[model samples]
Target: MNIAIGCDDAAVEFKNILKDYLVSLGYEYTDYSEAPKHSSNLYADVAERVARAVASNKHERGLIVCGTGIGVSIMANKVPGIRAALCHDVFSAVRARKSNGAQIITMGSRVIGPELAKTVLKSWLDADQIDESSLPKVQRIMELEDAIQLG
Candidate 1:
């Protein structure tokens, strides 16, 4: 699946490492990074763009990074149909996809090391979407989104 990736200065290093890992795994991805290390940019801007790419079907998924991952994740989730999961561990990464059908994975460079970040991304990539049993819950989430958007 093609993915959209983005990061602010705080997570540029981890983003680069993850991008290389994606390349090594033969996965295609588009970089939507705000800027390089020396530059300053908003994580929300990068997150919104990457989330939009996924929500619009321009990309299959998104990977966004910031200092704590919280800012990016919160911003990404503001877009309709974008389930951005802030994941730090392998289990959460796997469940984010398999259970919630999250289209975006947000990571924190300050909270986790590069090696662990790679592991989480790999786990997310290797996971499957929600099964029959979990479909209703995902559907409910979409329904809630719709209801909230309407009123």
Candidate 2:
């Protein structure tokens, strides 16, 4: 699956490490950051770009990184039709996709090490199918999002 990846200056190193990991895992990804080591754009801006790409179906999923991951997760979820989850562990990563049907996962560069991040990413990527029991819950989330956007 094609993945949209981006990060702010605070997580450039983490982003690069994950990018290489993505390649090693045989996944194609598009980097939305401005530069290799430094991104002038704010975390929210990068998150929105990646989230929109996934929401529009241009990419299958998105991975965003920030200093705390919270900023990007909140920003990405602001977009309509996007469920962005801030995940710090493999279980959360898997549940983000399996339970919430999240199309985007956000990670904190400063909070997680590279190996743990890779493990989380791998688990999330492997969780391709959403649980049937969670379908109604996911639908409710989308409905709430639509209602909020419409209002």
lDDT (0 to 1) per candidate:
0.92, 0.94
- Alpha carbon deviation, residue 151, candidate 2 (Å): 1.0
lDDT of 2 at 86: 98
Off by over 4 Å in 1: 35-40
Best candidate per lDDT, number? 2
The local distance difference test score of model 2 is 0.94
Task: Give one clash count per candidate, in the order shown.
Answer: 0, 0
lDDT of 2 by residue, 1-151 (tens): 8899999999999999999999999999999877436544899889988998999999999999999999999999988899999999999999999999999999999999999999999999999989999999999998888888889
Highest TM-score: give the candidate number.
2
Cα error of candidate 1 at position 29, Å: 1.0
Ten contiguous residues minimizing lDDT sum, candidate 1? 33-42
Writing each residue's lDDT as its tens digit, candidate 1 over 107-137 gives 9999999999999999998886676788999
